[model samples]
Target chain A: MDFKKITIFAGHYGSGKTNLAVNLAFHHKAQGRDCTICDLDIVNPYFRSKDSEEDFKAAGIRFISSPFANSNVDLPSIPAEAYSVFAKSDTYSVIDLGGDDRGSYALGRFSEFLTDESTYDMLMVINQYRPDTRTPEQVLEIKKEIEDACHVKFTGIVNNSNLGRETTVELIERTREFADECAKLLNLPLVMTTYSDKLEKPNMPNPFAINIMAKDIWQV
Target chain B: MAEKVLMKGNEALAEAAMRAGCRFFFGYPITPQTEVAAYMAKHMRKNGGTYLQAESEIAAINMVLGAASAGQRVLTSSSSPGISLKSEGISYLAGSDLPAVIINIQRGGPGLGGIQPSQSDYFQATRGLGHGDFHVIVVAPSTVQEMVNLTYDAFDMADLYRMPVMILGDGILGQMMEPAEFPTESSRKLPAKDWATTGTKGERKKNIVNSLYLDPAELERTNFERYERYEKIKATEQKAECFMTEDADIVVVAYGAAARVAKNAVLAARDAGIKVGIVRPITLWPYPSDTLKEVAKTAKAFLSVELSMGQMVEDIKLSIDCAKPVYLCNRTGGMVMKPDEVLAKIKEISGGLK
Candidate 1:
């Protein structure tokens, strides 16, 4: 799961991309690469990269947490620590963007610094089951909106499709064609299909599995 | 005409309002409901309509009152906390018998509770809003199609009774996208603004749109007249929808997004050979009480589901007004209840009767 020097994850909220990014961060760190993960979400602080600071620290992964002492404030504060990704060219960094266009637009401020820099991948995560992206057309519209907001092109697409805890192997299998339709619309490569299962199983379409960790502990 | 276009509920409802002859809008921006004002800002000016974002919710609602007093169709929208601030002005509109539409795309709240979707404001909406004996006509919509339908008709109904009308939605309904079709402009019907405060020009007689009455007896007489209008509205304007309710012994009652979840649970329960149905309240204030009371006569029990701390359950009991075991299945503080959990409650309640 070790990616390019800079890997940015973008998707709507509850698309399960945050958990997938967390898994990829630890995977890169375990592969003996210097890794950093930063929370680029100024819209919603819940279920973002900042909430997993302790776990990232345990794995020797540097985390750029939200600057606000109160996470709920609508302050547009992008941490200065996040710019280390642009400076340190060798660091395998993953950025968890805000859940929507409003959150994703923060990347536009750093567009000058992110110009074709030393190997980067910005993948738009698509979950077919999410209410906002029920169709391939909708997914394409969201991708265009994010591109318009961030002024950065999406390099690839990731099919992190699942129905929360009710996800099944067959459900994931059903999502493959939907993901393909979206990928074909954007002419982008399908990166990987992620599953919450940690097992190595054959006969499945793809095997990018994650031991899910980040969750809202405050949720009732 | 364009067949159907994908739009968020907030935007769709705003478009519908404009098509319904509402040429004036005043609202403050708030979470999960800002799309309405954003859309209005982009298009209201081009359409020869007036769109103003007030300094606050208080200022917005009063602007609505002012524009409506001039006999112009006007609208305003906000979320839970913002709606609370507008309640004082809404009460004033009710007292003055002015017609206006106020959309509350609800969010979790008691005091700036959270930005997530919730249904806890049923009490404040259906019961008297402020310090007055008045009721705003509350309409609850479960889908984007209904959001368009209800918002298009809210203005007409408000004018029909010369009272305040509310489109009580939640964050999910406001932010979620779906296909909606707008009514043809020619098909729209609006009463003439003859009662307008446009310069009297010494035509015949001046019109006063004030809500104040100095004498105690006069105030009491004005209230009686208002109650007479409310009674007429209640008799003719109750709306509801029933799903799989023909032969079901257990009924699940809910509205808005909570109704969406309950509909899924009822479908799953029906497939498992359990007789269950869902009764969705479309008009929540003049709530579908008569229909619910009739359905209660045949059902074994009633389960009123909500995304709040069990506020609508009180109305459910009042509608039936019986000992027929009207129970509650609820979640609060921005938590959405899952289908399996609600299904389990259905089984548990039905099991007790056996």
Candidate 2:
């Protein structure tokens, strides 16, 4: 059995953090592992785990949210339930943080939740199409902004660049290379890559595990 | 029968679609709505289903269109800006008389608006998302539980009417985690799809699914046919949940997340010795006009509470014939009206009655 570990995903706006978190949870769940996802996003008002709670429930995956997580315009505050999840030594947890620098601020509150060398993998998801994060250098700058705000080191990266339904293998490869280079430069592992199921298997040699989206992962 | 588990609105929508026999989903990541796509992606594959993270909202909707054309239960979701991009596809889906599900967990918007929840898309959603004459079935789910239940109804109505069904949600409803009992595993059944394009074979004629009709006369005929279907849908699918309105003197009109806020307001008013009730329209497109008209007859005044400045208020007035004073209580650009704010409006309007 794969031992339960905490995976934290962070990224810029439209960086596909939720996508990675949901996919990772599903991947673990498919392996007969118990997984819980806590949506800690109080920023980037849309595309968080809270939106698809029903689906998670049906899949026997537990979902946690903060108390102030509402649809109204207020920024979300991390709830006690989130801290409780992190406090636990057992059970695999994935925290899908919000997008943008605000996400970094949100991550700062969970500092106490991290334990020393606790096998927590902090992944920075990069989508090259979004502005302020198109190039590896831009991603590094965004990463620096997040690292500075959260005071946490990013351990790895995930490349999730795609041009919607028209995304081609070339585009995926280009993104993969960019992320790989960033990972190499940062001396971190290139954790995984994601592709819309619309793409046929690419010819490039796989250097990392691939996340093939079967559907909206959060929908259950 | 299946066991019931507590669920949130986003998750409930996924479960409801599954119950409706939905097997295909495509969507881009957006807040207050990412859960819908995430939920679908997680389980669809296990059930021998298809889930795709399309490149954009446009691709996702078109993917839904393609899958729906194949006679599969398919859905796509997004928030405000994403939904705006989907308008063209939505119009096309409506024009083609295709059955699919689209969800909009609304946020403030004209362009790249803040992510905070807002209901500013009322006019955009109900007034027709895209060009030409067409209407999609729009269901407003105020709670996480209703999000699930109504999503089931959305697929049913969509297929029944051969139109796209939309779950018009706000950021609050999409983001909040609440307890809800979900249907048991065994009780969920995939609906029959005789109209899908899963390869034309021995007994069935070739099925052509396209929105383009170059012949004006032919297009007109299709439009009339769709209108006829919409008429039937409007007559049958007008749904609203009335709370404490039976003997109340004041009726508050609201829907989606605003309805929940309004519910609290009504409860607070009742506590303060005010006889106020709420009429939450679950089906925004149908507008629940018949019920609102009935409630308007007895209520001294009707207050429309919403997150948008006053978009849905116009709908309320038009639906109820503005017989009584139709007052507006609203917040804009991702701001939500507090319960006290709504009660103050109710009190102010009630004072006028004296």
Candidate 3:
């Protein structure tokens, strides 16, 4: 309940940032706090946080994303209402950023607001199982690319590593050292290690359990 | 050996192609399938390959033609409209007898349809990928893991047949994430590129790769030769997955994303005491007629489930020579049919059979 005013989730593609963003928004809403989740995903054509717009609406949380989000039109046009995330100080803002540096370019437009350390927490969500970010050095390389593109530094690291559906508690425990190594190498605090709500919670520090929101088409 | 990892279908196909020794990728980005080009751009060079984002889909496919003619395992990918643009180059590749793998991560439409999953390009891919009396080996993958395996195999099939091979996927397959393992070693002994127009080093005569035949007699002769090769492929390369079809009275036929949905429906229908089975064709061009012909011996009726207005239904009818009634269960314009909808169709067909 003590998150920063604006929490931005950025990571590699399919690293579970969209799911974390949705969970964070629900987390804020459940605690009797107003929240707005803005989708800054231009790089990925499918699977964005905006896909849960109806769920967000039913929960009374504000959603801002491309008009083309969840539509037949595949455009990268971010809505003008996304600017309200910074202007409204009363509502907690969660930004679900697209994957990699190209995805982070949309974040560059809001660099002026994100510069203040106290107001925003820019977390680099990393999954060690992903092909591109399998190690601390690889994660760091992405961190630098994202930092360069968005012109904002990642304040902390979030370990959200797991194989989809085949994830086990043992696998989570095995990845603890990898997450710690990433934090150490990046010189950032380990903000949290997320696990799917469907699985039993593993014995890990900063355990943030999240509901899976960005689902495969077959799951429907 | 690379560890099994969770990958989006598009990325998995791109990664598999690289592992299959595909060193050149020429593509222009489009919806759903953009990740394939993006992945190639990010990692292809690291794997000792060339990834070029061409100015247009036409240019990209032509580039594939050029590289493939030089005996390099090359690839190009696009969505529905972009694939249409590349059709001319694809025909040229076939005409020139070059080997290349073309990926169509299908979206809806005749014009600029929708940016969602679709199988409407079934006719375009199987029957008329280009204006040619030739054929491209069209392989449709239902899962991301299959996307990996089929993509790795597509390159080999292209080379083995000395023609183009297609990996026909839909937006759902392109975007979904699944755990996939990459093959470390190829199963086939690839034929040497003696037919490649690599060059003359003064030791041998120069080889030429061309599609133009001015004389009508010469063109007809070449067409006959190509059809003979096509016949060989038809005999050997027809692949399908028959699920619970041994004693079923109603067999459902589908491919790609629609097949995945139809399989789920078939399972549900069987549980509900409706005798139903699914026949999923892995290769659309080869059509897997023999498998359907076999199933038709016992099946009272067949349902051709699709994401189009029944394009594959014609093939299903022809596959079995219309011995039994063939029904179409489909959704078009980016709308995918639900499992329940397909189950209802199976029930209707079963009721009529009774």
Candidate 4:
């Protein structure tokens, strides 16, 4: 639960950031803090943070996303209420950014406010199993791309390597070094390692348990 | 065996095509399927292939035609509306007997309908993708892993039959993540493209790739020959997966994302003591009529579940020759049918069964 006032999750497409963002918001809510989560994904058409709107409302956490979210219409427009994350100082805001540099362009709207490094932590969620960012070099390239798009440097890294529903603790353990190599290459602090709540918690540093929320109803 | 990796369906299909020896990819970005083009743009060049984001879907399909005419494996993908724009080119590809692969990650549609998952393109894909007496081999895959496997197979099939092969999917199948192991290499030994428009170098006759046969008798002869190839393909390549169809009184027919939901519903129905099973068609063009005919002999009734307004129901009726009543369970315009709804329909159909 130790984090900045504003935490941003950004990474390659399908890197499990939306799930992590939801879990982090709930974690802060459990600690009796006023938490708000924002969904800034315009790149992906499905399986986004907006899908967890009902869950956030049930947990008494404010959720901000596109008005056309979860609808047949797919617009890249973000809501005006998203700026409240920057304006509100007392509330804890966890922003679930869209994947890749193109997706990061939405974050650029609030770039002026994100300049205060003490208040915001942009964490690049790296999944080694993703086709686009499998190597440390690939991870660094994405980090730079995201930074250039949003004009905000990534403050830390989160190793969220997994093979969708097939993720195992043993798989996570084997992929730890890839995350470590990526963090070392980027010279960013390895913030946390995430594992699905479906699995037993593994013995790893900064373990964050997440529920895969963004999925089709029929997905097992 | 390669390690299983988490891949979005669009990316997986693009990778599968690349590994299947597809070196030319011309595409236009559309919702629910842009990842296929984006992935190709990022990796196709590094894999020693060409990835061009053409100005429009029409241009993209024509680019596919050019590459395919050269005897190179080519790919072009888009959503429902984009596929409509590519229809003219698709017809040309079929008319010229060019082998190419097309991916249609369907969205709700008549015209610019919506971006959510839909199987409404069933008729458009299987019956009439373009205006011609030709049929494209349409493969409908429900899972991301199947998306990969089918895409790889599609290229081989397109080459073997000298026709376009389409992987007809919906938004859900295009956007969802799943663990899939891509084939490192093609499983079949592909035949050489002797008919390709490669330079003759004055050694032989120059090959002409054209569909315009002005002579009426010649055109009729060509059409007959094409239908003969189609008949041969129909006999050899009809695929369907029957889940618990043995001795079931009620059989549900579905394909693509709808089949996934129907399977879950069939499992739920079985738990409630209602004898229900599912017939999932992998090849939509050939229609998998033989399997349906075989299941129809034992099954008392049929249910066609779809994400459209009863398009596949007609196919189910024709496949079974209407020996038994085939009911339709459907939702349209971006709304997918729920398993509970399908289960209720199945239970109702089971109760009415004589």
Please name the candidate that would achieve the greatest DockQ relative to the true structure. Answer: 4
lDDT against the true structure, per candidate, is: 0.81, 0.77, 0.90, 0.90
Give per-residue CA lDDT, model 4, range B189-303, as digits (tens): 7788999999999998999999898898998888899999999988989999999999789999999888888999999999999888899999998989999999999999999
**CAPRI quality band, candidate 2:** incorrect
Q: What share of the true interface contacts does candidate 3 keep?
A: 0.53
lDDT minimum window of 10 residues, candidate 4 chain A: A211-220
Worst 10 residues of 1 chain B by lDDT: B185-194
In order of appearance, the predictions have TM-scores of 0.75, 0.65, 0.97, 0.98
Worst 10 residues of 3 chain A by lDDT: A211-220
lDDT of 2 by residue, B39-72 (tens): 6776688778888998898998888888889887
- Which one wins by TM-score: 1 or 4? 4
Residue B225 CA displacement from its true place in model 2, Å: 1.9
Q: Which candidate do you rate higher for TM-score, 1 or 2?
A: 1
lDDT of 3 by residue, A42-115 (tens): 87777777778889999999998888887887777788888899984788999999989988999999898777
For B1-354, candidate 3 gives per-residue lDDT tens digits of: 567788999999999999999999999989989999999999999998899999999999999989998999999999999999999999999999999999999998989998988999999999999996989999999988899999888998999989999999999999999888898977877889998888888878888999999998999999999999999999999999999999999999999988888888998998999888989999998999999999999999999999999899899999989899999999999888888899889998888887
The DockQ score of candidate 1 comes to 0.09
Candidate 2, after superposition: displacement of residue B49 in Å? Answer: 1.1
Judge candidate 2 at residue B46 and give its lDDT. Answer: 78
Report the number of clashing residue pairs per model. Answer: 0, 48, 0, 0
- Compared with the true structure, model 3 gives a TM-score of 0.97
